[model samples]
Target: MNKKILISLATSAVLISSIYADTTSLGEITVTTATKTEKSIDGVTASVVVVTQEEIEKTGASTLDKILEKIPSINAQYARFPHPSSKSKASISLRGVGANGTLILIDGKRLSGETESPYEMTRITASMIERIEIVKGSMSTLYGSDAIGGVINIITKKIDKNETTIDIKYGSNGDGEAKNKNVNFITRAKVGTFKYKIYGNINDTTPYSISKSYSQVATNPSTGSAITTDAQHGVTGVSNVTYRDESTTKTIGTRFENDFSDNLKVGIDVNYFKENREGEYIGTAKYINSGTPILVKNTPVSSEDKNSRLDVSLDLEYFITEKLSLDTNIYRSYYKKRNYTNPINFTGPTNTKFSANVTIDGIESNLKYELNDLNFITSGIEYRKEKRESSAINPDPSSSEFITKVVKYKALFIQDEIVLNDTLNATIGARYDNISNADNKTTFQAGLVQKLGENTSLRANYAQGYRAPDIAELYVVSPSYKDGKRFGAEVIYGPKTTAYDLKPEESQTFELSLSNKYNDLSSQLTLFNTTVKDKIELVSYNDGTAAKYYTSENLDEVVIKGIEASFSYIFNDSFDLSLDATYLKTKDKSTGNELMYTPNISASIGANYQITKEFSSNLNFRYIGKQFTNSTNTTKANNYNLVDLGARYNINKHLQFYAGIDNIFDKKIEEELGTNVGRYFYTGIRVSF
Candidate 1:
């Protein structure tokens, strides 16, 4: 629709809005991700789920993954990577899509990480988060890349009062055993015209071992493939192994801001995150004999790692006029990761070392204008530059150990909103992105929302998706060094990813949803589907010699369809219940096969009971249906279910005590090569002043 027509429609709606505007409740949650400006959730045509502070506190969970797992639409799973790196750690998936497809943000800024997974979950505590706004659909028109699955915007705590808090917790796998521990400190105060807030958190957790020894390993009866020992060691049959991994995270952050005048404000924020991880993985020798299956003989690899990241940001805002405002942000992030691995009684490389460093710098400026009470417009420009350096020292020094990659990106985006009628709204947006490595492209989105009555509303949207190639996928080089000159050994080179050889992934996504809010019950149902072309996948190529290398290549197509349903009932101030479920169907149309690591069915149900204001209890249950781990569908990750229980008590205003048990039934599942943790218990206390 054109601007003139949209404005006229909104003007008519404003006139009619006077008839029944006072009959509805005035309280509505304001969201920023859907419109890039604070507005009521009902004013947007997108689907958004808000995890409020009250919800976070009642979950009794310390980690973001555990807290999000109870949401029906989230496919939250964390695993140990077969190939170790800073990026191979904990991750979160949505709607059965891979974690890499989802874009995660903190306070409207990018949180840098490996393209494979997000490893920053343990750095921040739940107490540091004020709320999380989840936008479930394509948002490429606003955010440049990696928005095919969805967007998660985490809003951190902003202190409204001078306060200090101390939180501590201890956890275990079973009775009288220690497994996890956490401690956090937070404080905020106002001095003169400046306000400041600081936070510190420390988390430590022991390892979880799926199997005790190689003797306990066996083959899969369904796929006719080995389960425990094959995917880990690249061996076919034998089982002779033991596995253990542990992690520790330490984080500290501070935010300082001041208002120079009533029309302008400035702020500076900084954070540091450090993590230590170590693990031992054992497997059998390679299977060369011509037999049905091989055997494992207890050969293993042990590794230890140290990773750290630093983030610094500056914010500026000014009121250019009464109807116009400017917002600008600049951020820089640096990541340093190093690891050492050694083979034990194996016929592989010995004393191998791998290290990587990534640096990212970004800047963005946005201008918002309110044309009238029913019209809002926003325009922004963003630029980002990233550099990656990876090095490895193998048992053979001549194999080469260095690779560097760099990328520069810029984007321009604009969005318009109009209140077409008292019960109707419309949104139109577009973005143009330029990448140093590939052809520039433009994307667009349009949506509509209509309120049928005080209790019902409908939403529909169509959007475009875009994703640039990852650093590991392109611009990689391995120059074999013998006396710092070209040697006899073959040098591995990444395949040049041209617009045709490896085209940028393009997708079209659509969603339709209905929501209802009654006296005591609220429900939402959404149907979504997406079609993608030129899907990217890692492919191996021979360097026309003994050496082999890998690069990403474009696949034919992919189709995904899914349904999400959620409902909540508040019986009173003392009792509340919620249930949600998701069913997904996805396929790699080129191969006529289901996508990997996507479950067909998943759901979560929970209830909260409060006997009094200071005493409360909560119970939650989650289930994940069967899924495949391999492209051929020969390997499987069996279905699993888990239950959790928690309770909290307050002795007075300054003292509180809480306890929680995760995986209450001791449920365990062998995902691919590693296993999920067992039952864990924790107790803690909080003090606030």
Candidate 2:
């Protein structure tokens, strides 16, 4: 079916569902990401999803990515285990945009470091989270960059009392075919006005393959006899590739804070995460005469990588007057990573290593003033500096290059909230940013909220977004050297351009939404459209020779239009049901074709039933629709559906046991754009005090 028809159907569904609801107020949860302050999500003029601790606990999902996949209009690559290549790493996409367009923060701080932001979600554990807030649409008026699609802010748990929690889980694929294990320990303590929180995690898993073929044998044309060659005879068969990769991970994190006074506070956060992956290269050396593929070398490869992040911040607030207050924030972060690859060939073994170090420091001050009973004002200024160093990058087997780069940014923003009367509210905000060696840009936003009744509200907003290129995209130097032969070295650095000035990614977004909250039911409907210009993309062209050179440039203009609907109903206090769905229509303006890697339809439905005071059950259904894999829309990804079932038994207040089967139907997992895990069963026990 065409996307237009699908869009119309989705719109009809949203309008149809909104007709029935009671007159009630919204929930009491306050979201800080929408306006950089504590404000109820119902009053905000943008689309946001808040996942509470209670909601997360009921899902029984081990990883953050697995649970986030249930949210409407959110897409991510789903893999049971981390893969060996960069492409296999987990990444989040909003609407139909790629990972680069969205920004991710941990505890209101940048967790992305020098790497791609979306992939960094792997380092966070859902067990340590208090809540997560996801805001959709352009937010450049508040945050400086990469707020085109939206932002995801993860708020970790804080220590208020003394407590310890331990959880253990074991899982297997399809009747104990492959085994996986996880263990986690979390603790929090309070001493006077000082508090501390810490967490530790360990994960290990075995590999699973979709294909059972271990080796390929050659056949004689005339005699029809099978020919087998061993490694000793200079020929080998490739094996151990496909489906999912295997890995082991260990993580440790801690946060320390002191409330010296009501007006001053300080905190520091430290985290160390490490993971190792094992796999065999399954490449064919040549196609033999009899059509059998032969491998000259078969080697098992192992990689170990480490990540560390440290944050120290101080906050001070003082009231100069009864209606005015000043807040100051100073923070600095140091992130480091190291990767080692061991290609252990049966014949020859060699190891490759690379490392990166990045440091960022920033400070901000905000002033809030209540002009009157009807108007409120907020303004802030920030300055940030970043430096990155890399040991070496080997684009080819024979070449390695070292790189170092530094950049600075300054930003100023101001926003006002106006209450004209009891039934109407409006907001206006703007920001200006200056970056080193790039264009200075200004972004703005305006929004309105109109109450339809005691239980319903309609919100409309228009926003402008901006994003500066990341360090890797702007200046990572990968010099390619030809084979060592002549007197001079032939060096090439690409995507590093000096020929033409590159424009930053810019976007304009408009959205209209309606939300209703009743005694037992809550529903939200949002319709949005976004247009992006100067989208940064990797491109290549022939440079007056037979060879092609690559560079990053501002290439295409894209338009993404979509609608999201969410519904939740409580059937008494013991049972509940929730469902959400998204329909997106993204097109490249230059070609009038759907953008690559974007799904047109995706949905999730979940139910929780309490059988008794001691036992409860939860079931979730997910459907991922078809998507185009290539930019030109030449290849299509298969659509898939998954069913997950779990149950929990409480053995008093201090002990509990829960188990679940992910992909219960043994459905074929999607290769890249959908679920990529097999049917797996897991059981776990938790102890807390």
Maximum-lDDT candidate: 1
> Which ranges in model 2 have alpha carbons more than 4 Å from their true place?
1-22, 77-84, 112-114, 175-179, 208-237, 242-245, 280-302, 316-322, 342-354, 391-401, 475-501, 539-551
Candidate 1 segments whose C-alpha is farther than 4 A from its true place:
1-27, 77-88, 175-178, 212-244, 283-298, 346-353, 392-400, 475-500, 538-551
lDDT at 147, model 2: 75
> Please, what is the whole-model Cα lDDT of each candidate in the order they appear?
0.70, 0.68
- Top candidate when judged by TM-score against the true structure: 2
After TM-score superposition, what is the CA distance of residue 443 in candidate 1 from its true location, in Å?
Answer: 0.8
| CA RMSD of each candidate after superposition | 8.7, 6.8
Candidate 2 yields a Cα-based lDDT of 0.68
- What is candidate 2's TM-score against the reference? 0.85
Candidate 2 lDDT tens digits, 1-689: 34565456455544654565445777777898988877878778878889998777777766687678777577874321112333345567787666777778777776526445533654566678889999888888887877777888888887877999998888888755557687898999999878898999887767664432333323232222334553322334444443334666778888888877766566777776666655443321222333443222223334455656666666666776878888777777777766555433332222332457778888888888889998889999988888777644333322234466677889999999889799889889999999884789999999999988777789999999988776655443221111000010122333222444567888999999887776777777788998989876544444442223344567579888887877788998789998788888888788787866678888888999999999999999988788876556778897778888999999999999998888888888555553355788889999999
Candidate 1, clashing residue pairs?
Answer: 214-240, 214-241, 238-294, 238-295, 238-296, 239-296
Ten contiguous residues with the weakest lDDT in model 1 = 480-489
